[model samples]
Target: MDSQKKFWRSLWQLRVPNKIKHFMWKACNDALPTKENLHRRHVMDSTTCDLCREHLEDTIHALWLCKDISCVWSSLEWFHQAILVQPANFRELLARFRPCQDEYKVEIFVIAAWCVWNRRNALHFNRVVSLVTSICREAVFRASNVAGVGVIFRDNRGDPIGAMSMPVPFGQSMVEMEALACQRAVQFALEIGLTRVVVIEAFLNGSGQLASFENILGDIRFQAACFQHVEFNYISCACNSVADALAKKASSALVLQEWLEDLPDDIAPLVFREVH
Candidate 1:
């Protein structure tokens, strides 16, 4: 019981976005709307795994043990080797990974699990099947380093309003880069006279315990106060590809670059695909 409490504490303290942490909490608690739980509640007619259709779609099967989703985990050599045991439940499955001791590994594990759930939902609801490689790639990227920051503005219909990319200074940590990105995103929203804005970030510091990024986050909060409504959303890197590309573009660009409706030719295609 003590170890389980400690696990929950560590999970809540992770630097990943709040939504992912909440998703993990729901998964561990069997509170997620997996097919088995939904069927038990009379919400779903069938409890079979939508992706694999070979087993009950409990939180454990949907996220970790599903045959269709196995490739996503096995793609990462470390995860493949770490999860040799097939645990009975979601909590036991997470315990096999020992998420509390190593923060980096835990972050990757949580993100990957969230991606699995997201992919499952997409397939089950929207009939959109995403590649396992894409899921794995997104999880790794979100947990890995931050080279730069990218901000893009769009309207309700996904029309591009504006976008910007800025390079991060040397010696800054990943969380610091994410904070800088938030600060710049808010500043850009204000510049464009957007009274209501939604900031979509691939990574965010949910826990403000790190002193290094707290000031930056504070500035973000302060600047965000300028707008009538400002909302922050956490999205997978796959959905955030344009911003990801812009951040990579920042490395070679001499100065901070901004674009209006006419984004650079390279990024325009990505946005096109994202919206359509």
Candidate 2:
């Protein structure tokens, strides 16, 4: 009981976003909407995981043990230590990190778990599975501030055709930065003489009621009309590593960067991973 209390205390003290803390709380309490919980409530007919279909979908299995989600954890350097001890539940899995001195690793674990849950939901609903590298990149993105924008243009074969990265002014919200990125991507597409374009965004959920977000999205829509055919698809950050990497690169770059068919050394690996 004291350990449980200690867990709660440490959880609230962590520096992660409140939404992540709330998610951790739900996970610890088994209050998450996992298929097992949904089955108990008659909300879902099967407790089997939709992603793996090999085991019952509980908080632990969904977040940690699922084969599909396990790669996200395995790809992390610190996760090797955490994975040594088999956790019986989500709370136990988190508890392993609680005593660790490095708070950043704790934050990564929490955020990655949350992202895995999100990916599970996305796959369940949309049938889109994000790559392991994208999930890892997203964990880093959430922990940092928005400093720039990145855009990558890919062919229907998922080969890179062009890319751009640019530093932007700080102090704007993430949604605003995402909006700016979308605008820049549209402009990039137009400048390259691409008529039919597809914009895959990791943000820009279109649910933001903020006036600034609405205005920027409106501008993007207006600019998109310039294309003969354009489609905007929303995927979670778990599928946007190449652009995320470029944005991270642009955050430190002094000037706008662009590329033709050849991608930079750093981004080429990401695109290759996505293509294969």
Tell me how many residue pairs clash in candidate 2: 0
Which residue pairs clash within candidate 1?
none
All predictions: root-mean-square deviation over Cα? 12.4, 7.4
Q: Return the lDDT, model 1, position 192.
A: 81
- lDDT of every predicted structure (CA atoms): 0.78, 0.82
Model 1, 134-196: lDDT tens digits are 676456456643355788999999989999987666334445666677789899989988999
How high is the lDDT of residue 207 in model 2? Answer: 59
lDDT score, candidate 2, position 99: 78
Q: What are the per-residue Cα lDDT tens digits for candidate 2 across 1-276?
A: 997777799999887889999999999999999989999999989899888889999999988988877778887667877888788998888888887755366877888888888878877788666565557645645544336688999999999989999977654455667778888999999999899998998665745535856777788888898999998899765588899879878865647999998999989999999889
- Position 265, candidate 1: lDDT: 91
In angstroms, give how far residue 162 of model 1 lies from its true place. 37
lDDT of 1 at 224: 92
